[model samples]
Target: MIGICKSFGANKVLGGVNLHVRPGEVHALMGENGAGKSTLMNILTGIHRADAGTIMVDGKEVTFKNNKDAEEHGIAFIHQELNIWPNLSVLENLFLMNQPKTRFGTIDFKKMREMAEAKCQEIGIDLPLDEIAGECSVGQQQMTEITRSLMLDAKTVIMDEPTAALTERETDRLFEVMKKLKNKGVSIIYISHRMEEVFANCDTITVMRDGQTISSRPTEETNMDQIVGDMVGRIMSEYYPARTNVPGDEIFRVEGFTQPGVFRDISFNLRKGEILGVAGLMGAGRTEIMRAIFGVDPHESGKLYFEGKEIHIKNPRDAIRHGFGFITENRKTEGLILDFSIERNIALPSEERLAQSHVINDKKEFDFSSELSKRLGVKAQDINLPASTLSGGNQQKVVIAKWVGMHPKLLILDEPTRGIDIGAKKDIYDLMNELTAKGVSIIMVSSELPEVIGMSDRILVIHEGRAAGIVEHKDATQTRIMTLATGGE
Candidate 1:
């Protein structure tokens, strides 16, 4: 794509952006969320039209009419959000519309199974063909999506944050697949926020900021500092800010939290002005425990104490009423209503407090949400715009802003910075410190060990649904936490 430009009304998303990907190369597209990487690819795949640009395939200018047209031209896009049908079987999902037909024109189940099994074996992935897609782990679902794209024999594959949901093992497998595809002369456009993955796996790196391409270089030639500087337009002297707030007395406690097969014997406590990091591998029951604690799910046996008083949290409303806030990991589905305006989303939880005599005060609601949005540094032209109009980083801020408006004594953040950029991550870290300084306790669950070490006053490692050990911030290291997270001493 050369000189690509796109605009959404007054918002110019991509401005003269240029990208070049070579055959058989793994090119990493680095950018903060909403930096036009996805927009450029969407143009390439015919999801959206560029106001002005040129797309040349094999030195020939071409235009794709739709995603299917792009696929037919050997270009496939695997979005950051995996598109999977929960009720369908893995095999069914794999060949949904493109299934083989028998001599009599009936669907050929045997042929589909054989082809799927062959593809799985070729990629070194083991998937249950008949199992419900929803029953599969997130990693499995991710692999299924990749396999679907590969089945089209796509020459150029655009993968957006493919490793966000994968475990270390799964990520390694994905890297191996990328290497194999490269050997076969297939180009991969890898879009991710994980700097380590980019430097280690990619052959080239391209950085975008504010809808424009800032720089592109071979992976070996550029360092992280330069790339980060290009991304955020400044040198980030500190990735994670220092915390000045000293933790006070215990504010919340969970004892013997059990949910039968999901999690067992989970015990932890949160102190006032503390940021407790929950560290564990994927599917280690970390998210499950958080959901149970927030009363979104049931726990067979557990005791929750708020301010030293026993509290029975039967639902999320109960937890919220008792000053608990939860920022769910899947923010797109659980955290905010996408169709609602940003102001509405920010004011959703605080309606009761912003009301008088069972009637909502519109001015009070708008003023309250607007204040919180600005405090969180939410970038938007108008708060009246739909929540879906903002970028991933800003959406996360809105989620946090809503919870902050409630004045929660304890907040639960599950993968708070999962799909956001480095600048946004720093912003959130700073916000956490600010909240803790004001005496609001936080329990942060994250897969990134570096984040846990950098932000947490105390790190709690969960191994196979059990608390392996708790390490103080001074004692927390990647090795120590990994050892504990994997059932080591």
Candidate 2:
């Protein structure tokens, strides 16, 4: 893509950007949130037409009318959000648009199964072809999407945060598959926030800032600090801000929280103004424990206390009534109604408060949403735009704003910065410090070890549905947390 320029209404997202990827090379795209990386890719894939640009494929100028046109040219995009049919089997999802048919005009189940198995083997994945796509793990679902692209004989594949939800083991397997593809002369455009993944896998790096390209270099010619500087347009001395609040009295406590086949005997305390970080490998039950505590998935047996008094939280409504708020891991699916406007999504949890005699006061709702959105630094031309129109980081801020409007004493954040950029991550960390200074207790579950170590006052490492141990911030190290997370002392 050359000279790609795009705009959403008055907002110019891409301004004459250029990108080039070599065949059989894994090209890494680095940028801060809202930096136009997604916009350029969308234009290339025909999701949106570039206001000004030219695309050349194999030295031949080409125009894509839609995603199908791009796909027909062997340009496949595996979006950050996996697209799969929950009710369909893995094989069915792989062949969703283009399925093999027998000579008699019947579905070729036998041939489909064989092809699915072969693709899984080629991708270094072990997945059950007959299993429902929703039942498969996140890693398996991601692999299934990649398999679909490969089946289309995609020559240039674009992967957006493919390992965002994968475990360390699963990520390793993905890297192996990427290498195999590279060896087979398939070029890949890889987008990710994790620096380690870029340095470990990608051969070349391209950095973008604001709406234009900043720099492009070989992986061996650049370092994380340099890349971050280019993406954020400054030197970042600290990844996390200093904790300013001293712990006060215990604000919330859970004892003997148990869920059959999930988390068991989970006990923890959240003191006033404390940021309690939870760390563990995937499937270690960190998210399960938080969901149970928030009453989204109530535990089989548990005792909850707020300020030394036992309380029963039968459901999420009950939990909310008790001054508890949860920002779920998957924001699109659980945290926000994408179709709703920003003001509506921000005021969703506090509808009753924005009502007068059961009738919503539009002025009050608008004022409250505006206040919270500004406080969270949500960048948008109008608060009436659909929530889906915002970038990933801004959408997360909307979710946080929604809960902040409720004025909850305790807030739970699950993978709060999973897919956002470095600048956005710093913004969230600063926001956490501000929230704690204002006396809001936080319980954060993160897959990133560095984030857990940097932001937490104390880290709780979980292993196999059990609490391995809690380490203080001063004592917490990546190695220590990994040891405990893997069932070591």
Candidate 3:
């Protein structure tokens, strides 16, 4: 694509952007959340039309009418969000709207099974073909999407944050498959926020900022600092900010937190002003434990205490009433209402406080939301814009602002910075320090080991739904945490 330009009303998403991918090469696309990467890809796949641009596929200029048209032209896009049908089986999902038939006009289940098994074996992934897609883990669902894309035999495949939901072992398997595909003369457009993965796996790198291409260089020619500098337009002196908040006496404790078949014997504690990092492999019940503690899900047996006194939480309202806030992992669905304005979403939890005699005070709500949004450094034209209009980083800031407005003693942040850029990540870390300084304890559940080690005063490693070990900041290392997370001693 050359000179691609797109506009969404007054917002110019892509401004004369350019991208060139060689055949059989892994090209990495690096950018902040609103850097026009997604918009460019959407235009390539015909999800949106470019105001001005030209695309050349195999030296022939052509335009795609839709994603299906792009697929027909040997270009496939695997979105970050898995497009799996929850009610259908894995096999059914793999062949939805595209299935082979026998001479008698009947679906060929045998052929589908054989093809799926072959693809799974080739990718070194084991998926239950007959199981419901909804019943599978996020990693499994991601693999299902990858397998479906590979089945298309496309020449160019666009992958957006493919490993976000995968385990270390699964990620290794995916890289192996990517290598094999490259050897087969297939081109790949890799989009991710992981600097290490991009540097290690990709052959070339392209950075975009504010709807324009900043630079495109060979992976060997460019360094991380330069790429980060180009993306955020500044040099990051430090990736994780310093923490000065000293943890006080234990203010929250959980004893023998169990959820029967899900998790068992989960136990931990949090100090008055501390960030406790929870680390584990995907599907290791880290999220489940937090969900149960926050009353979003039930626990069969557990004991909760706050300020040295026993307490009971049967639901989220009770948890909130007792000064607990939970920022869920899936922010789009559980954290904020996309259609609601930023002010409304931020003021959601504080409705009772912002109301008088069962009626809301619009001015108070607006002022409260405006203050928190500015405090969190949420970048928006106006507070009345819908939450969906903000970038991922800004959306996350809104979620934090919403919970922070409630003045919770203990805040649970699950995957707090999952899909944001490095610049935004530093902003969040700084905000966390500010909150901790103000005496708010935090329990952060994360998959990124560096984040766990960087921000946590103490790290809890969960293995197979059990508490493997808890290591202090001075004693924590990626290897040690990974060992404990994978059922090591």
Listed per model in order, the count of residue pairs whose N, CA or C atoms clash below 3 Å is 0, 0, 0
Ranking by lDDT: 1, 3, 2
What is the clash count of model 1? 0
- lDDT per residue for candidate 1 within 334-388, as digits (tens), equals 9999999999999998899889998999999999989999988898999999999
Query: After superposition, which runs of candidate 3 have C-alpha atoms over 4 Å from their true positions?
Result: 377-394
User: Positional deviation of 316 in candidate 2, in angstroms?
Assistant: 0.8
Model 1 residue runs over 4 Å out of place are: none
Superposed Cα deviation of residue 115, candidate 3 (Å): 2.1
Model 3, span 177-232: residue lDDT tens: 99999999999999999999999999999999999999999999999999999999
| Candidate 1 worst ten-residue window by lDDT | 388-397
Candidate 2 positional error at 253, Å: 1.4
**What TM value does model 3 have?**
0.96
Q: How do the candidates rank by TM-score, highest first?
A: 1, 2, 3
- Alpha carbon lDDT of each predicted model: 0.92, 0.91, 0.92
Q: Would you estimate the TM-scores of all the predictions?
A: 0.97, 0.97, 0.96
User: What is the Cα-based lDDT of residue 393 in candidate 2?
Assistant: 77
- Looking at candidate 3, what is the lDDT of residue 173? 94
